[model samples]
Target chain A: MNRRAFLATTAAGAAVAAFPAILKAQGGDTIKVGFPGPTTGPFGALAKDQQQGASVAMEEINAKGGILGRRLEILFRDDQLKPAVGAQRTKELIENERCEFIVGGLAAHVQMAINEQTKKAGKLFISVSQSDEITARPDWGPLTFHEALNPTITSRAVGNWLAQNLGKKWWILYADYAWGKQNNAVLTEVLKRQGGVLLGSTPYPLGNPEFSAHLPKILAAKPEVLVTMTPGADNIAFLKQAISFGMKKEMKIAQPLHWLPQLKEGGPDLYADIYAGINFSWQLEDAIPEAKNYVALYRKKHNEPPGDYSAYAYSAIHEVARGITLAKVVNSDAVASALIANPVYNHYKGKQWWRACDHKAFQDLWIVKGRERSKMKGEWDFVDIVQKVAASEELDRSCKEKGFV
Target chain B: MAELTLATLAAQAFTGLVLGMILVLLAIGLSLIFGLMTVVNFAHGSLYMLGAYLGFFLIGYTKSFWLALVVAPLLVGALGFGIERFLVRPLYGRSIDDPLLLTFGLSLVMVETVRLIWGKIGLTLDPPRELAGAVNLGFTYFPLYRLFVIGVTVVVLVALFVFLEKTNVGLIIRAGSRDPLMVKALGFDLGRVWLLVFGIGTALAGLAGILAGPMRGVYAEMGVTIIIESFVVVVVGGMGSLVGAIVAGIAIGEVVSLTTLFAPKFAEIMVFIVMALVLLVRPSGLFGESGLME
Candidate 1:
C-alpha cells in the first residue's frame, strides 16, 4: 500500500480498537480509579500488599451497593518504581483507561511523577506514598491529596521517642536520596533539640548491598542510637548484615518507618527490638472499634495483617469513595471540596482528616517495636505498639509553610 | 569525621576481602562461559538467585545448610546443562549477540518464575550455628560467617586451580576453549565439554548465591542488582581470564569497602571508575587474549 493508504488504515484500526472501550465507559455502571504501584522490583511485595488492601476496599464498597450507586473498580498498573514509568502509567490510566481518579504510589520520588501527571490531566490523585514535597510548595494542587504520613511526621515521632528513651548519643545511617536525606535532617533537628549529641552520619547509595564497612565506623563512634533510613530491600540487607556484625547488641536500632510486611518476612530474630514510627498497625484494633472491624475484614481475605502501605491504600480508596458519595458527582473539584468540608473520617484507625490547606492527611502516627519470637501470639503478630502520637495540626507543616496562606 | 584508627582500617580491609570473594565466585562463572563459547552469560545472576532459593527450600526440608550447599549447586548446574543443550546450542555459530540475547531473555523468565513460586518478600537464612556470631580479632569484631566465606572460597579456588592446571580433562577443556575445531579433530566430543563447562560455570554462581543468602537475604530481584557488579568484575578482570576474575573481584571489593570508610558517597561509583580507568589503560582488559578490534 502507498503511504497515504497505510496511514489511513492504521488510524482506522486504532479507532476501531478504541470503540469498545468507549462503549464500556458509556455504560456508567462503574467508577474507575487508577492505582499505579511498583508491582515489580525490590518493593514488589509492599506494592502487592497495597493492591491487596485496595482489593478489600473495592469489595466492601461494591458490597455496600457500590459508591453513589455505581460499582467501584480499580485499574492496577505497574510503575516499576521508576519516575518516568510512573508518569507514563498515570497518563495511560487517565487517557486510555478513563479512570476518574488515581491512587497508590509505593516510592516517594515516583509518587511526585504520578502527581505531576494527575495535575496536568485534572484528575483527583490520592497518593499513598510519603513525600514532603508532594503536599508542600510547588507540587501541591487542589486535586493532589496525600494519605500517607510524610517523613517529617515519621522522623519527629520516632526521633523524639528515641531521644527521650533510647539515649543521647546518635548516629544516622541514611540512604542517599531525597526521602532519606529529608528524614535524616528532620531526625537530626529533633535530636538536637532534645539535647542529644550527634556522633556521626553515614550516607550510602540506595540499593547498596553491604553495610559491614560502615559498621566499623558506627561501632568506633560508639553511638547509643543508630538510626537507619534504608528502605525496602536495602533495609533488609542492612539489618541482616548489621545483625551479623552484632551491632544490635551494642546499640539501639531505629528507623522512621517499619514495614510490617518486611517484619513478617524477616521474622522477629532480625526485626525484634528495632523501634520505628508507623502510619498504622493492626494492633490498634484493641483500642479502636473501626480498626478492629477493618482488621477482621482484611483477615478473612488475607492470612496476614494489613501492612502500613495497605492501610494508606485502604484509606485513600475509602475516603475518595466517601467524597464522591458526599458530592453526588464525579467531578474532581466538587469531590475535593466535599472532602475538604468534611475532614474527619474513620475507616481503619482512629480519626484521620485531610487538612484543607494542602489536602495533606493528618493521622495518628505510632511508635512500635517488633515482638520477640516467643511472645508472638500468631504468625502476623510481629509488633507491639509502644506509643501513639495523636493527630494534630502541630505535627504537620503550617498552612503558611505549605505556601497556601 | 569518625576517627579511622588502625583497627578500623584492618576491619574494613577484612570486610572488603569477604565481599571480593563473593564477587570472585560470581565472576569466575561468567568468565568461564565467555572464555569457552564467547557468549556472555547474562543469566549467570539468575542462576545465583535460583541457587539461593533452592538452598532456602532445601534447608527448610532437610534442616541442614551443608546438604543444601552441596545439592543446590548441583541442581542449578543441571538446569544450566539443560539451558546450554536446548537454548544455547543452536546459536553456537551465529553472532555472539544471539546467545547473549537469548540468555538475557532467560534471565527475565527465571526471575518471574521465582516470584511466582516464592513471592516477592526477602527471606533470611541464618548462617550455620557454628559460624553465627562475631569473632573478636585484635583490631575489631568481625562476623565469623564472613571469615568462613573467605576460607571456603580460598579452598574452592585452590581446588579449581589444580583441576584446571593439572588434570587431563582440564587440559582438554582449556584446549577446547582456545581451539574447539582442533579439539574436535583430536576425536574429543567438544559438545560435551562445552556442556560440562557451562554447568560448572553456573554451579559456581549457585554456590555464590547460597553463600550470599545469610549475608544479603534471598529475593527474586536479588540477581538484578548483583549482575551489573559481577559484569564489572568480569570485564575489569579480562572477560575470559580466570586469574583476572579472581584478582579483579578482590580488588574491586576492597576499593568499594575502603571507599565507604573514607568517602561513603563514592563507594559504588569507585567500582565503575576503576573499570573505566582499566579499560582506558588496556582496551581489551587486564589479561584479555585479543585487542578490541580483533
Candidate 2:
C-alpha cells in the first residue's frame, strides 16, 4: 500500500478511539454519584437503610428536573465494611465508572480509606459515617466533607448532659474497637470537665455473647450512670442481659446509638428509660417541621420512621444535588469547590454546614429515652426525645486544639 | 463487691439452667457425630445455621411452625448425608487431621453459600403464638419461649437417651463406634451405619438451629460464633461421650449465665478457661476414654 493511504487509515483509527473520551469530557447528560458502603455484613441493615434514603432523595431530585437539567444517577458499590474493600471500590468508581462525586461511609475505617483515595483522585467525598474530627481540621484533605455528627462532639455532649441531668459518677463499658475507644476517651474528658468522676471503664470484645465478666465489675463499681458505645446485636444483647442482671435499677444506661430500633428489637422492657444520643428522631416533630415532614414522607413510602442512617443518607444526596446546582457543572473539582465554599444548607435535621477547617458538619443532637410499650402506640415506637442539644453548644473546640480539622 | 444476695443468685441459677439447655441441644449432635464416625465435624455449626434459615423460610411460606420444625431438620440431615457419603467417606482411612481440615473448609464454603443465597442481613423469626411472651415466675419474669426451649431440649435428650440405650439400630451404631472392623466382620453394612450416624448427628444440630432461630437473629455468620463455643463444650465433655456433652454443656451454660451476673465482659472467655482447666485436670476429658480411637 502507499504511504499516504497507510497514514490516513492510522489517523482515522486514532480519532475513533479518542472520540468517546472527548464526548465524555464535553459533559454528558447524566450526573453520576458513587456510593460505597457496607451493604452486607454486621452493619448490613444500616447499609440497606442508607441505600433506601439515597435512592429516595435522588428520586426527589429527578422529579424536580435533576441538577442543571441532568438526571442524577447513583452507582452504588458494596464496600463489605472493610477498609481494603472501601479503598479498592473507591478507586474503581473514580477511575473506571468515572463517577463525578462520591458519598456514603458506614464505618469510620471505611471512611478513612475513602478519604485517602478520594484525596489522591482529587474528588469530593461526603462521608455519612461518624469519625469525630475529620472535617473541621486543617490537616484533613481538601476534597473531603462530612454530613454526620462527629463522635467526639456527640460523646462529649452526652457525657456533659448525663453529668448535669443524671449524676456525677459515671462508668464506661465500650466495645474494644477504635470507634468505641475514641468515644470513651472523649466522654471521659467531657464528663471530667463537667465536674463528674469517672469511676471505672472496661472494653469488651466485639460480638462477645455474654457480658457477665464485665457486669460484675460494673456492678461492683456501682456508678450512678453507665455509658455504652455498643451497636447492632451486641447492644441488644447487652441491654437484655443488663436488665436481667438488675444493672438498670442501680445505674442509668446511656448509649450513643441507643435510639436505634435494634435496641427495641431486644424487647421494649429491656431498653425502657435508657438514654441515647441521636441526630434526628421521628418524635422530634416539635423541634423541626422538616423533620416532621421527613418522618411522614419516610413512613408513607417505607411504612416506617426514618432511622439515623436513613436520614443522613437522604440528606447527603440532597446536599450533593444542591452542590451540583450551585456549581452548574458535574465535574468533581467544580462540585467540590461549591460544597466547600457554601454555608450550611437547611437539611432534614435543620440548618447545617460543613466546617471548612476539618470538613465536619455540625448539627443538633437529641437525647432520647426508651419508653414502655404500654405508652407506645405502635411496634416501631420506643424512644421519646428528652432534649434537643444545639450543634454550637455541643461541639467541642478540642477538635481544633487536637489538630483534627 | 457487696455480698451476693440469695434472690439474685437464685435468678442467675435459673438463667444458667435456661442457657445450659440451649448448649445441651447444640452439643449433642457434635458429640454423637464424633462418637460414631471418629470425625470432628467442624461444619456442624453451618448445619445449625442452615436449619434456622430453612425454618425461617418454611415458616414464612407455610405459616405453620410445626411444619417448619419437622421439615428443616430433615433437609439439613439429607445435606449432611450427602457430605458424608461423597466427601467424608473417601477420607475415612486418612489421618484424623484430614477430616478436621476438610470439615473446616466445608464450613467456609457453606457459610459463603448461605451469604450469597440469603444476603448478609440478619433475620429475626417470631416465636409461635403460644410461646411468644414472658412468664412471671413470682421472683422474676422469664421469657416463655426460653422456657419452652428447655422443655423441648429435655424431651429430645430423653428420647435420644432411650433410642441409644434401647433400639437395635442404636445398639449397632454404638457397637460400631467401639469397633467398626468387628461390625464389618459380622457381615453388617458398616457404611450404612456410619451414614445413619452422620445424618442423625447433623439433624440434631439442625434441630438446635430451628429452636434458636426465634431466640436469636438468623444470619450468615450466626454459626461462626456458636461453633467455637460448641467445640469448647465437646472438649470439656470428653470428646464423644453423650452424657459428658450434656453435663459439660449445662455447666458451661451456667458458668456463662452466672458470670454475666457478676462480670459480663469475661463471660465469653470463661468457656475457654473452663475447657483449659478441664484439660489440665482430666487430659482425656470428663467422659473421654483414652486411646479409644488410636
Candidate 3:
C-alpha cells in the first residue's frame, strides 16, 4: 500500500495531465471545426457527399494559408440522422474538442435541435440541410448560419415555374412526414398565388415500396403536373412507377428538391421530363468558371462530381474560412460578426448574399429539366438548366417579413 | 372529392391485388419457417436484402435481369441452408431464446456487411424493357411490371400450395409441424425437414426481394422497410397458417389501397389499427391454434 499503490496513483495523475498536451500536439495550432451528419442511414449518400465537400475545402484552405496563420482541422462525427445524437455531438465538439466553428446538418429536426445547442454555447453553426424553421425564429441567434436553400423558397420557385410552363393544374404525391408536409404547404400556397388549381394530393408513408395503388388515383386527377415531395428511395419508387404507367408522357413531374444521390440511384431516366428548383448544380459549372474550377477540384479529390449538397457543404466551409481570415481571429464572435456584416461574396456562383435578418443566403435558383439519357454527356450529368432565377426577386417573403425578429 | 367511377374502382382493386401478392410472398416465407422450426426468423428480412443486392450485382456482371432474378434467390436459398445448418442447427436443442438471439445479432451482421460491400447509397435495377411500359386494359392503363409482379406471385403461390399439399415432403412437413415427436417416431429425420423448410422459406423471401428490386431502390436498409410489415402480416394471418397469411396479406393490402382513395395520410397507420382490432377479437390470430407449431 505504501510503495506500489503510491507509484500507481502518481502514474494516473501524470496521464490525466498529459491528455490536453497530447491533443495540442496532434492538432498543432489548427482551427478545429466539427462536422456532424448522417453517415449510415437511408440518407448516408448525401451526408458523405456533403462531408467530402467540406473536407476538400479544408485541404485546399490549408494548402495555401489557413485562417490566422494556422492549418484548418476538421473533427467528423456521424449523427445517424438522429436529433439527440446530433445535439450531443454538437456539445461534445464545442465543449470537449474546443471546436471554434461547426458545420453540416442533414435532417431538418437534427439541425433544429443542434441550433438550440450551438446558440446556447455561442458557437458558430452552419446548416447544410434544408430546414426553413432553423434560420427563422423570434430567438434567432447571431451565431447560427443557414447554407442550404429553404424548403418553402425552393418549392415556391418550382411552383411558379411549373404554372407558367405546364398549365395551372397540379397533383401532389408526397411522403407523410414533417419535411414532406412542409413542402406540400409551401407548394400549395405558391400554386394558389400563381392562380394554379390543386387538382389532388396523396401522401404515402416514409420508405413505402409500392406506389402503384396511389399512382392510379394521381393519374385520374388529369392534372397537368405531378409534384412529388419525397426524396431518396421513395422518390425513386414513385417516379419508376409513374414512368411505368405512362404518367411521364401525360404530365410533367415537379420535384421540389434535387438530391444528386437519389438521381444517380434512379438513373437519368427519372429526369426525362421532371422539373425541379434548386440553388446549386454541378452543371452550373458551364455558366461560371469558378463553379467549373470547384467541380474539377472536388472531382480530382473525390473521383466523383460533387452533388448539390456536396457543393453547398464545400462552399459553406470556405465561407467560414473567408470570415475567419477577414476577422483575423479564430473566435466565434469575430467570425459571426464579420460574416453578417459582409454578406455578399463570390465563390461557386456570380454573387450570393447571406441576409442579415434570417442568415439565409440568396443566390440564383437553377430551374432544371431531366436531361435525357441520350443527351447526357457524362455519368454524373443529369439535369439541364431551364432558367436561372435571381434568388432575391423569385424567392417568397423572407423570414423578416414572416414576423421573425 | 372527385366522383369515383366503376373504372376507377376496378383499377384500384387491381393495384391493391398486386400489393397484396408481394405481402403474401413475404408473409408465407415468415409463416413457413415458424411452422417448421418453431424458430421466429428475425434474420429473414436480412436474407431478403441479400437477395436484392446479389441480384443487382449479378445484373451488372451478366447484363441479364432475367438470369439474376432466377439465380439470386437460389443462391440466397443455399446461403440460408448453410446459416441454418451451422448457425441455427446448433441451438435447436437449447432454449428457444438462443436461436432468437443468434438471428437478431446475425441480422445486424448481414445489414452491416451489405452496407460495406455496396456502400450506403442506393443502387438502381432497371426493369426489363418489355415490362417498362403500360398495358392498356380499356378500364385503366396499368403498369406492365406491376402486372408482372402479380403474375409471379400467383405462380409462386400455386407452386407452394402444391408442394405443401400434394407431395410427400409437404406431408412430412405438415406432419412435422403438427407433431415433431410423432414424425420422428415414424422414422422421419426431422432435422433434414427443418433445414429444407428453412431453406425454401428464405428462398421465397429472396424471390420477393428480387421482384421488389426494380420497384424499390436496392439499398442496405431495404430489408428494414419490409420486415415489420411482414411481421404484422404473419401475426395478423396467424402464426403458422399459410392460408391465413394469404388472406391477411390481401386484406391488409386492400385496406391500405382503399384508404388511399379517402385518407392517404392514415394508410400506414390504418394497417396497424386493423391489426390491433383483429388481435383484440382473435387472441391467437385468424387461424392460430393451440400448440399449432409445437
Reference-based TM-score, model 1: 0.89
Our tally of clashes for model 3 stands at: 1
Is candidate 2 or 3 superior in lDDT?
3
User: Rank order by DockQ, top first?
Assistant: 3, 1, 2
Q: TM-score for every candidate vs. truth?
A: 0.89, 0.81, 0.92
Candidate 3 overall lDDT versus native: 0.85
Cα lDDT tens digits for candidate 1, B1-294: 678799888889999999899999999999988898888999999999999999999999999999999999999999999999999999998988899899999999999899899886677888998889888897888899999999989998999899999999899989988888999999999899899989999999999999999998898878887889999998998989999999999999999999999999999889999999999998778877774223
Query: What's the DockQ for every one of the candidates?
Result: 0.55, 0.22, 0.59
* Candidate 3 lDDT score at position A297: 88
Docking class of 2: incorrect
Ranking by lDDT: 1, 3, 2
lDDT of 3 by residue, B1-294 (tens): 446888888888888887788789889988999877878888988888888999998999999999998999999899989989999998887776788889989989998999788887777788888888898988789988888998899999999899999999999999998889999999999889988998898898888888888887687788886788888888898999999899999888898888887888888888899899988999668987755544
Query: Against the true structure, whose TM-score is highest?
Result: 3
In model 3, chain B matches the true chain B with a TM-score of 0.96
* Model 1 chain A poorest 10 in a row by lDDT: A21-30
What are the per-residue Cα lDDT tens digits for candidate 2 across A318-392?
988988889887766777778779957876878887766666677888888888879987877778888888877
